[model samples]
Target: MRRSFRVLLCLAATAVGLTTLSAPANAAAHNYVALGDSYSSGVGTGGTYSGGGCKRSTNAYPQLWANTHAPASFNFAACSGATTTDVLNSQLGSLTARTTLVTISIGGNDAGFVDVITTCTLGSDSTCVNRVEQGKTFARNTLPARLDNVYSAIRQRSPSARVVVLGYPRFYKVPGSCNVGLSDTKRSAINSGADVLAQVTAQRAAAAGFTFVDIRGAWTGHEICSGDWWLNSLTWPVEESYHPNKNGQARGYLPALNAVTG
Candidate 1:
């Protein structure tokens, strides 16, 4: 009958409308926020990111990923001197309901690992090794709890966000050439320090149901002392500077972007 035909047509129209409605939500563009330390801030990499005046650079990994992938909205709250608490308190505020991706690199400063490196360079003896080892142990024990809190705070702030915790790259190669005293053995210890810290960070992020992007292997050929190094080849106030040059950042961070966006 005509009445039956009308009801069938109405149902089909409603189904089509429902499909159309669901499509947009499913296809909704993503919002991204990046939070972390100097490496994440893109300090030496030297390009101006959005909110450039905040001191974050355009070539920073977050901006790179956003520009390469074209997210719907982007926030780069990564500051040069950020720590774990800094990320949870200051950077977490930048995240919102629309944020689909959140990335961070933290805990190196928390462990005061940089100071240990400086001290080791000042003198190479059992005393120096002991001090560095002590710092490493402390970082291994204490950093995870703080990172856990950071992840928890982030998830609470943006439940829909895919949080990615990035590990720091190995600054020195097998035999760092920064100083004459930096022997192969000493350099190994430094690499070990970075490896431990990175693994701990990744493990903590994984425990919180977030993704952890390890960039150590990705940056194998581009370490600090390597020719055309991505990281600075020497310490501050020293030779060629030890942070990532533009090439280093591109090599160091691109794999992370690929892993994350894929």
Candidate 2:
């Protein structure tokens, strides 16, 4: 009887060890998908990826977020010029039951960020201001609905996955002594629009039962004119303009990190 009992104990321990070893192998087969725009794609920040040209970068924020927090089986579907709708119709097809995480940073392009830049560089004063205000309205009104659709589709596709909605950082600084070509009134208008955008995104996050990672606060002192700005100034030193650089991407990661794990 003692010998029989010893044999049974050994069999049970072997079974447990096999289960433990297989668990990681099973998990390794799962997936994670990242969906968003250039901010998520890591353009201009460096770290080129194969096959994506400049649209996708290995060092982008979502990839950074994934490296820091995601499961091992994740794929970044972020493109530089992707709009909110692009995420739902294209990026989401990559997800399956094995998918476990989805992170997004969108709505900027849909709100006419491209037009803002293009029109500003070429248009006259009235045309620029008018275009900016028009874009602001679109961002405030149309973007939330687009975000809602994308968020909902992601939830439907990957029911068990963790979703993260990342907010945009403050682009312009508050009015101060060092006013660049852009006026304080214009800056205030832009900031107000951005604030509204953040608010709506937060609301969408709550509705979808996902985490809303606010990048604005972490970017407070890192605006364009600050000595240690995360993003480069839009008006000068041409190589760095209108987007987050390495410092900005690095700084932006903190809020995302705090949101997912905290």
lDDT values for all models: 0.75, 0.72
Quality of model 1 by C-alpha lDDT: 0.75
- What residue runs in model 2 are displaced by over 4 Å at the alpha carbon? 1-30, 47-54, 120-129, 176-180, 235-240
- Residues 1-262, candidate 2, lDDT per residue (tens digit)? 9999999999999999998888643333336687888777776564445435426766666666556654578787877778877787778887776677777888888888767756655666567678778877786687778888988888888898878788887777775446456666555655665777788889878888998888888888877666567775553434236778877776676455545644
Which candidate achieves the best TM-score against the true structure? 1
Q: Note the residue pairs that clash in candidate 1.
A: 47-58, 48-58, 49-57, 49-58, 230-248, 232-241, 232-242, 232-243
Clashes of 1: 8
Q: Model 1 off-target regions past 4 Å?
A: 1-28, 47-54, 176-181, 235-241
My TM-score estimates for the predictions, one after another, are 0.83, 0.79
Find the 10 residues in a row with the least total lDDT in model 1: 233-242
Candidate 1 structure quality by residue, lDDT tens digits, 96-118: 87788888888888887667677
